[model samples]
Each structure stands twice: as structure tokens, then as C-alpha cells.
Target: MESMLIEKSVQGDVESFEKLIVKYNRYVYNIAFRMMGNEEDAKDMSQETLIKAFKAIGQFKMESNFSTWLYRITINVCKDELRKRKETVLSYDAPLNEDEVTLKDTLKDETYNPLLIYEKLELRSSIENALNQLSEDSKSVVILKDIMGYSYEEIGAILEIPIGTVRSRLNRSRTTLKNILQIQLSEN
Candidate 1:
């Protein structure tokens, strides 16, 4: 079913493309959120990735996984945005927006234990903080393989690196995150 969508999308069928979006939007948003750290930037990056993917759909290889291809675009779009943000300055005087929402906000379930929820949220927040400390390459590998559950081979295809490189980078990324997290836990 997905392969059919991919074929039709490549052939410029808009309805097929929209169907594809329905299947992959969540995955794209997840990657973007992990890469960009905040809700607004993640949504922006995800939108850019979708636009780029739509433009380049004709170039995608049918044998490759659609999720893998979309993930690559998401990462590249994020990397570009990071580069742009690195050079841009933020004004401390700028007003703060009170309406910012997060994925955590949407997952509210009164049935869940409040204590369990607090602990999980704290742990996730710590991990995300640690992840932000990693270099982009290391962060990408960790997010792809560990957080998003992509196989090492899929990560290689998404990042355009060798499998061995993926393994090494993931190892180093994990080590750094572990160290950072330990420090956080110790401090707490």
C-alpha cells in the first residue's frame, strides 16, 4: 500500500502524496522535535522537510524506505535551520509568548499516576537536555537509532554514512549523554 503511494507521489499525484503525509507526518514531527528541541522550531522544520520532500519526490528510490527518506530530509532541514540559528542573535528584550505548547501537554491522561508521570517527565527532560549537549552528528545518530528506533542500516541511509561510523558515533553519543545525565542526577 505504501509502495503504491510512493509510486503515485513520484508521478505527481497530489492525493497520493497527501495520503503519504498521513502515514509519515508523526514520524517527521518526532524527528524534528528531537532535533530542534522546542515545539515551534520542530513544526517549522517538519514543514520545511515536507516541502522539500514533495519537491524531490521524483528523485526518491522506490527500493528505499519512505520513512528513511523522510527522516533524511528532516535531519537536513534541521541541520540547515541550526546553522541559520547559530548565526542569528536573539534579543533578550523580546517579549515572551505564553501560548507555547509541547507534546507533553497533549498527552495528559488523568488515569495515569501523578507521581509516575512526574518521574517520567523529569527523566525525559533530563535526557533531552543531555541530548542538546551533543554535536549535531552525534545527536542525529542517537536520535535515529535510540530514540526513534530506526535500525543501524536505516540510520546509515538517513545520515549517508557508513554503518561502522554509525556504530561509533552512537557509542560516543551515548557515553556523553550518560555522563551528562549522571551529573544531572548527582546534582539533583
Candidate 2:
């Protein structure tokens, strides 16, 4: 079914492309948010990714995973924006107007205890702060692998790097994140 859509989309069918947008826009937005650290930038980057995808749909290889290709476009867009802007670290406690629950929420346990909740929120903030400290290369690897659950092979494809490089980046990023979190904990 999706192959048919991809085929039509490649043939310059607007409707088919719109269908593809409906299917993958949220994934693109999630990647954008992880990369950009704010809803507004994520929204804008997601739109830009879709536009780029639409323009390049004809060049998409049918044998490849469509989601991976879309993710690649999204990552590239975010990387470009991050490069131009240099720095942006937004708070996670900001208002959420939509009903879409993110991966962060899913990983968290549903706890009613106030102290546990507070600690969890604080830890989350520290982790995000740690993530922000990582270089773009490491941050993308960690986000794609740990947060987004992309396999190493898939991450390599999405980031257009070798799988070995992806593994090393993820390993190094994880170690750095752990060290950062440890220091934060010691300070508190």
C-alpha cells in the first residue's frame, strides 16, 4: 500500500505525497524536537523536512525504508538549522498544547508520589542538560539510538555514516552523558 503511494508520489502526485506526509510528519517532528529542543523550532523544521522530501521524492529509492529516508531528511534539516543558530536549549516543562505523548513520557513510570515525581523531573532536566552538552554528532547518535530506538544499522543509514562510526559515537556519547549526570548528582 505504501509502495503504491511512494510510486505515485515519485510520479509527482500531490495526493500521494500528502498521504506520505500524514504518515510520517509526526516522526519528523519528534526528531526535530530532539534536535532543536523546542516545539516551535521542531514545528518549523518538520515543515521544512516535508518540503524537502516532497521536492526530492522522485529521487527516493524504492528498495530502501521510507521512514529512514524521511528521518535522514529531518536530521539534515535540523543539523543545518542548529549549525546556523549555534545554540538553543529549551525547557521541557513548557506548555504542551497537543495530545501527542512523546517518547520521553512513555519511558517514564506512572507515579503518583510527589517526591518521586519531583526527583524524576529533576533527573529528566539534568539528562536533557547533559544531552545538550554533547556535540551534534554524539547528540544525534544518542537520540536516534537510545531515544528513538533506531537500530545501529538504521541510524547509520539515517545519518549517512558507517555503522562502526555510529557505534563508537553512541558509546562515547553514553559515557559522556553518564559522566555529566554523575557530576550533576554530586553537585546536588
Candidate 3:
């Protein structure tokens, strides 16, 4: 079914292209959100990625799966955005008072106790802070493997790097994240 959509899209069928976009929109936006760390930037990056993909669809070869190809495009778009921003530090601190319910809490089940929700929020913030400390390459590897659940081979293909490099980068990223989290926990 998707292959047919891709074929029609490649042939310049606007409806087919819209269908394809509808199917993968959330997937692309999620990657963008994780990489960019904000809704505005993620939306911009995702929009740009889909536009570029649509323009280049006619040139796309069928060797790789459509999702993989889209991923490659999304990564490149994000990398470009990151470069333009040139911002190093990402602030994870919530501006609201301590007692205020966070956005994370709203998304989670309401049955949980407030204390448990706060604890989870802290953990999530700590992890995000640690992730922000990593270099872009290391961060991408960790997000792709650990967060997005891509296979090592898939990661390598998406990043255009060797599988061995993916493994080593992932190992180093995990170690760095673990050490950072430990330090955060000890301080708290």
C-alpha cells in the first residue's frame, strides 16, 4: 500500500504525496523534536524536511527503505538547523514555581501521586541535561540507538558511517550519560 503511494508520489500525484506526508509526519516530527529539544524549532525542521523530501522525491532511488531515506533527510535538516543556531547550552530548568504541575506531568497518567510525578520529572530533566552535554555526533548516535530503537546497521546507514563507529560512539555516549546521571543523583 505504501509502495503504491510512493510510486504515485514520485510520479507527481499531489494527493499521494499528501498521504505519504500524513503517514510519516509524526515520525519525522518526533525525531525533529528530540534533536531540536523544542516545539517551534522541531516544527520548522520537520516542515523543511518534508518540503525538501517532496522536491527530491523524483530523484530518490529505491535502494533503501522510504523511512530510512526520510530519516537521512531529517537528520541533515536538523544538523543544518543546529549549525545555524550555534547554541551550545540547552537550559532544562522550568520557569514555574516548584509546586506547579509540569508539562510532563500533564502528559503522564493522572492516577500517579504528585511526589512520584515530581521524581520522574527530575529524572527526565537530568537525562535531558546530560544528553545536551554530548557532542552532536554522540547525541545523534544515542538518540537513534537508545531512544529511537534503530539497529546498529540502520544507524550506520542513516548516518553514513561504519557499523563499528556506531557501536563505539553508542558505547561512549552511554558511558557519558551514565556518569552524568550518577553525578546528578549524588548531588540531589
Candidate 4:
């Protein structure tokens, strides 16, 4: 079905292109949101990514899955946006603060204690802060592999790096994150 959509889209079928956008919009937006660490920028980046994909559909080779191709585009769009903004650190807490629903509500545990929830939230905040401290390259690798659960090869393809490089960067990122977390805990 995806292949059919891609074929039609490549043939200049507007409806087919729209269908592809509808199918992958959320995935693209999530990647942008995670990379940008804000909703508005994420939405803009996602829209730009889809527009680029639509325009360049003909150039897309069938060697990769459409989703992977889309991911590559999304990453590039984000990198460009980041460069334009000249911003390195991002606040992952922005979206959470704007949401009406609480994490406890989402967890939906009958035995959920407010104190425990507070502790969890604190830990999550610490983790996000640590993540923001990483360099863009390390942060992207960590988010793709650890947060988004992409395979090393898939991340390699997305980031245009070797699989070994992906593994090594991920290891270093994880170590940095762990150290940051430890320091945060000890300080608390």
C-alpha cells in the first residue's frame, strides 16, 4: 500500500501525496518535536519536511522504506532550522507545561501516589535537562536510538553515518547522560 502511494505520488498525484502526508504526519511531527524541543518549531519543521518530500518525491530512490526517507528529510529540516536559530540547548519541558493532562492521568494507575508521581516528574525533568546538555550530534543519535527506538543501521542511514559510529556516539551520549543524572541526584 505504501509503495502504491509512493508510485502514485511520484507520478504527480496530489491525492496520493496527501494520503502519504496524512499517514506519516504524526511520525514526522514527533521527530521534529523531539529534535526541536518545542511544538511550534516542530510543526513548522514537519510541514517544511513534507513539502520538501513532495517536491523531491521523484528523486527518492526505492532503496529505503518511505518512512526512512521521510525521517532523513525531517532530520535535515531540523538541522537546518537549528542552524538558522543558532540555538544549541532546547527546553523539552515547554510542551508538558502547556498540556492540560498530567502524566499521572496518562499512567492511569489506581495505586498511583502523588508523591511518587512528583518524584517521577522530577527525574524526567532532570533527564530532559541532561539531554539538552549534549551536543546536537550526540543528542540526535540518542533520541533516534534510545527514545525513538530506531535500529543502529536505520539511524546510520538517517544521520548518514556508519553503524559503528552510531554505536559509539550512542555509548558516549548514554555515558554523559548517566553522569549528568548522577550529579543531579547527588546535588539533590
- lDDT digits (tens) for residues 66-153 of candidate 3: 8888988998898888878787742222121234433334445544453344478788888887776665677788888878899999
Candidate 2 Cα outliers beyond 4 Å, as residue runs? 88-118
Candidate lDDT scores, in order, read 0.78, 0.78, 0.77, 0.78
Stretches of model 4 off by over 4 angstroms after superposition? 89-118, 182-188
Q: What is candidate 1's lDDT per residue for 10-31, written digit by digit as tens?
A: 8888889889888789989988
TM-scores, one per candidate? 0.77, 0.78, 0.77, 0.77
How many clashing residue pairs, candidate 1? Answer: 0
**Candidate 4, residues 73-149: lDDT per residue as tens digits?**
99889888787878745333222222344344545663555435447888888887777666567678888888889
lDDT of 3 at 154: 95
lDDT of 2 at 2: 91
lDDT for 59 (candidate 2): 92
**Which segments of candidate 1 are over 4 A away from where they belong?**
87-120
- Candidate number that wins on TM-score, 2 or 4: 2
